[model samples]
Target: MRIRVGKHGNSLGFVIPASVVRERGLEVGQEYELQLTSSGGLELLPVNQVIWKPDLSIDELLAGLPQEKLVYEDVPEYVPMGKELDW
Candidate 1:
């Protein structure tokens, strides 16, 4: 689909289609990093930064630092599962 660059408050920008935004989970006023590919196509990426760790390696990183342990005692009883009943 082709979209024309239109003027908004003296600034020019293209209107992103609603289907494209919904499919990509994009929102209005959200930041995006735009870059030109080697083949001359534009790449639009979400500027929302997220930090994610795969596993306990992050815990190990924290363990290397000085930290205080919690003083709470463990609760002992396990809650048993109830028998299945038809609705």
Candidate 2:
């Protein structure tokens, strides 16, 4: 896809196509880090982008953990001392 640079106020800017925006999950007013590649090509990367999988369940998220490590062998019983709130 080709985009032409035009004047925006006192600066030159280009419009990002809606198709590319939707594909990349880009949001309005989101900041990006502009970089110049070794080959001299321009690259834009999302700033502080988080890689998350919200669809994963708790069990699925912990599937990689060893079974033995999941269980606590022994835990001291809680005893309420003076001035401490007891439930």
Candidate 3:
């Protein structure tokens, strides 16, 4: 499909076809990130779907952290703020 870059308030924008938008679950005002590939191709991804570039290997990343981080924090003692319930 062909789309032309048009002017909008002195800025340029192109409209994604309705079929493409509906199929991709895209919505107005949603965020998108455009990636330029090494082979000179463009890739689009939702902000949440993008893999960050500062990729860290699991072994290297985890080696710095302590095992205690896996443990859940102890539950605190509960104090009544008001009159106790009759029940």
Candidate 4:
């Protein structure tokens, strides 16, 4: 499909049709790697096959971290002062 490259802020961009986006399950904030093919074509690849979603659990998020660098520290309880809203 022919798409027009138009000015986006200070950069140029093209719009991906909604149909294509839905078919590919693309997310608005998902990261991708852009590559230039030898035949002068553009290719986009997801940085990770599994894109992070807001509903992911804390354990799921931490699973991506290296086990060697995992650290836990006890945080001191804070006393609210000056009409601070405490939950």
Candidate 5:
């Protein structure tokens, strides 16, 4: 886990080993949150969800009224649609 600080263009970074990367099934272009511990240790955490939260007014809600029904398909009694199997 000892990585040397290397120059990366205008920034500096540590080279993560391929064995560690493959074992964790990590990919390129993925972002990880780094935490600095009081004991001088680095911890990497993966970000899963990024949700957009916006403030909406009553006028915005009224304008977003849909003309169509939310569910267009008929529900069958035998099939379990919750499992997400597409017919």
Candidate 6:
């Protein structure tokens, strides 16, 4: 585990042994969450999901940003074409 921290441009980075990386099936560009433990240990864990990021809203989605977007995007199937609902 004990890998030395190296300089990565303006950021600091470290190298994991190929054996460890290969065993874990980790890729070079794969996302990971780094944490500092109270016990003075650093943990690099694979990110299952982005924890720090907020869920994207409809307005935020690029597809929904166009002028042809609607508040209710889902097509209602209750009333069929050429037919009316009986009350």
TM-score to true structure, per model: 0.48, 0.52, 0.53, 0.53, 0.47, 0.47
What tens-digit string does per-residue lDDT give for candidate 3 at 6-79? 99998888888999998899877889998999999778789999988767788888887776643223335645
Q: What is the C-alpha lDDT of each candidate?
A: 0.72, 0.77, 0.78, 0.76, 0.72, 0.71
Instruction: Name the runs in model 3 displaced over 4 angstroms.
Output: 55-87
Superposed Cα deviation of residue 81, candidate 1 (Å): 73
Give the candidate number with the greatest lDDT.
3
How high a TM-score does candidate 1 get? 0.48
In Å, residue 22's CA in model 3 sits off its true spot by 1.0
Q: Total clashing residue pairs per candidate? A: 0, 0, 0, 0, 0, 0
Better of 2 and 5 by TM-score: 2
With a 3 Å backbone cut-off (N, CA, C), the pairs that clash in candidate 2 are: none
Model 6: residues >4 Å from true position, as ranges?
49-87
Clashing pairs in 6: none
Clash pairs detected, candidate 4:
none
Worst 10 residues of 5 by lDDT: 70-79
**Relative to the unseen true structure, what is the C-alpha lDDT of residue 29 in candidate 5, on a scale of 0 to 100?**
85
